[model samples]
Target: MSDSNTTVFTNPSSFILLGIPGLEVAHIWISIPFCAMYAIAVLGNFTILLIVRMETSLHAPMYYFLCRLAVIDLVLSTVTLPKMLSIFWFNSREIDFSACFTQLYFIHCFTVIETGILVALAFDRYVAICNPLRYSTILTNRVVAKIGMAVLLRGSLLTLPRPFLETRWPYCRTNVIAHTYCEHIAVVKLACADIRFSSYYGLLVIFLVTGPDVSFITFSYIQILRAIFSLPTKDARLKTFGTCGSHLCVILAFYIPALFSIFTHQYGHNVPLHFHVITANMYLLLPPMLNPIIYGVRTKQIRDRLLHLLTHKGT
Candidate 1:
């Protein structure tokens, strides 16, 4: 028994990330789209950050939350994608123990922080629509700063236990992570011990963060819609709803894919491994890529700013 434990530490213990398991022959081919998406995701989110910073007119609560969200998206896209592209482009799949855990921490941290920012944005919309008279007074600069800090600290604090949890388990089984990114459970599965505690804690964290977050955001929108309908003018109704349309679309895009991935991971026992892994990858990458597009196309201010930048560059 002691000999086995010693062997587990000294053997081929570094994780071999099986990125799209059976598609080894086609990995180089598959890298093309991944590379393109990574570039777009990084560039788009960076543009959002830059526009928010440079445009003094955009220093409102809405744009402030957006700035925070853009930061999270950039980190999320950056942390997960380069390594994944490396897997595809160069077949670099071996990840050491501490490195894998570090990746896992940031991946989840960004996810939870994204949810918090979405909720913060939802509250901003709700106040704007429901109590327009006090919107500015209520969500002042100080209040907005507090909320941003809260979102950042909350995500950091909640997931702080992850490294400790991961450290408890020793990897003695095959060190091949089934997915490209270092997901908590995927890494935990490589442990030889029972995983009930880790699994339940993970579920608890997900439910605690995402459950209330989704519900709160949905409720905020419901209130916003009702307040819009109460407005007397048709133009008022259209303008107010249109203002929120982009956020609504964003909520749907993010949650639909995320929920589907979660259900498929938990219940789709007979699903193909590559399909599951690819879907997981999509959940992380797609939002970062599409979020900037959705905001740029739907939000007039961002759209006009982006257009002005482009036309100026063209000239």
Candidate 2:
């Protein structure tokens, strides 16, 4: 163990990720479900992209947003899963210093992008249902392109500071991280220098992303509900509600685990370290795995097109 005075500002060339602290014995067993989730997420997200790409009838603001989401989910899962599996399956726990920060950047970057996309999707649904006549006029291809650009730009700019901030800290305490992957907070905690700024900045990033996005999504849904209830008949109301249900489910799937993980990591004093690790991984995995399935089952066009593709692929 190196002391703070001697090792201050001496960055290690590489860091050892402990996979899951206290669960080394069960790493192999834990990997089984993680592998399954990764496989399903990859296949499902790729299938979603392929289906959206090939179907001209599916060309609309909603489907376009869904494609953006599929791409985000694909990249998000790809960023963390393989490395995690390597640690678990092959015992490859060492990650280069720069590589760890890179992983940290992409993981948080795409997560913020996904949140923005979800908000955009909610706005799309709000326009489609609440202002049907203006839907085409409002969310044109140009407008959608701009929205996509904004989401990417915001996510990139916000998360770009994370690696820089983390790298500034002197890792004199240890190079062993208790988590499976290079999570920003976990990596920052190893620093011997004052980490208060890093911690506050992390909270700031979370607040800036979640504060406005959640408020907007909630406002959109509230208006959507008002529009839904004012429908002249029961069937009309049901139809509108059903249309928004899948997006609602996806939003819940994304936010619930994510918020839980964040809160537990920050404040859950009694929570086991293993539980934090598992929840962190789950927040990343569950949304990507469930998003496509929820959309496929809930959206009639996607369901029919997916079924058609599967059935005809054999012939």
Candidate 3:
């Protein structure tokens, strides 16, 4: 490929990601699995949303936050999976520059929003556990709605600059994105202009959004653990831990791979391309898949309600 037709990168337009010559073979092999995962993620998250909406008994602050989470998971998975599945199945891995940027915007937006939602959920748990007498008055439906709106607004504001900055750059080179979806870093790296400012801004936004969120979550859990330990009876302590176990499991599953992917992409770029791709997909796909299962098995109310719904539907 000619230099004029490629972006100003270290590599040329014909550069194969991960040193693989073409994506045709990989696409064929990955299509089936990707399709299955996409289907499962969509259906599972949708079911959780429906269950939360329909079950009046489950319409508490916790379930309200859960419903919000289900929506976020659905949006997050939907933003990337369908496009990815299409690429794999149709062998049309090409994405228009504008569409790629749009995808990148939403991907970052949903990710930020989900992080905020998780933080909000942690706060909700904290209120319930630490201030049982005031929990009802504190976490009313109106308050949850306001929190949801704020989270969405913050996510949108933080990620809007990324795509806006990307659009200003001229893409004079090949448009082939090696990854399945148009990731923020990957797309920005393809720009023909200096991206140091953009990168720094991106990192700053990430830190602002995730740093305090993760810290608050950790603090909430610490206090929860302390409260559990202080319970006079062994059974009470066990029950308290058991009640929060599902949330903790989901939190770990969501954050650990996410941080790993971030570290690998930023600092461990020298690692194998296949490894990066696998970990990236795990970060994108695993939380949605595991979240429903975690709640279903760990939370008695959700599990019983889901089972009842299934049995009633069968009849």
lDDT score at residue 98, model 3, on the 0-100 scale:
68
Compare the candidates by TM-score and give the number of the best one. 2
- In terms of lDDT, the poorest run of 10 residues in model 2 is 1-10
Q: How many pairs of residues collide in each model?
A: 0, 0, 3
Cα deviation in Å at residue 161, candidate 3? 1.1
* Tens-place lDDT digits, model 1, residues 9-86: 523446778778778788888778888888888888889888888788998999989888778888988888888888
Per-candidate local distance difference test: 0.83, 0.90, 0.78
Better of 1 and 3 by TM-score: 1
* Clashes, model 1: 0
- Which digits, one per residue and each the tens of the lDDT, describe model 3 over residues 254-307? 999998998998799678766777678779888888888788788898888889
Which 10 residues in a row give candidate 3 its minimum summed lDDT?
Answer: 12-21
TM-score of each: 0.94, 0.95, 0.91
lDDT per residue for candidate 2 within 1-315, as digits (tens), equals 234224444588888888988899999999999999999899988888889889999999999999999999999899899999999999998899999999889888999999999999999999999999999999999999999999999999998876887787678777778899997778887887788877678789978999999999999999999999999999999988999999999999999998899799779989999999999999999999999999989999999999898889878
Give me the displacement of residue 223 in model 2, in angstroms.
0.7
Against the true structure, candidate 2 reaches a TM-score of 0.95
Ranking of predictions according to TM-score = 2, 1, 3
Regions of model 1 farther than 4 Å from truth? 1-13
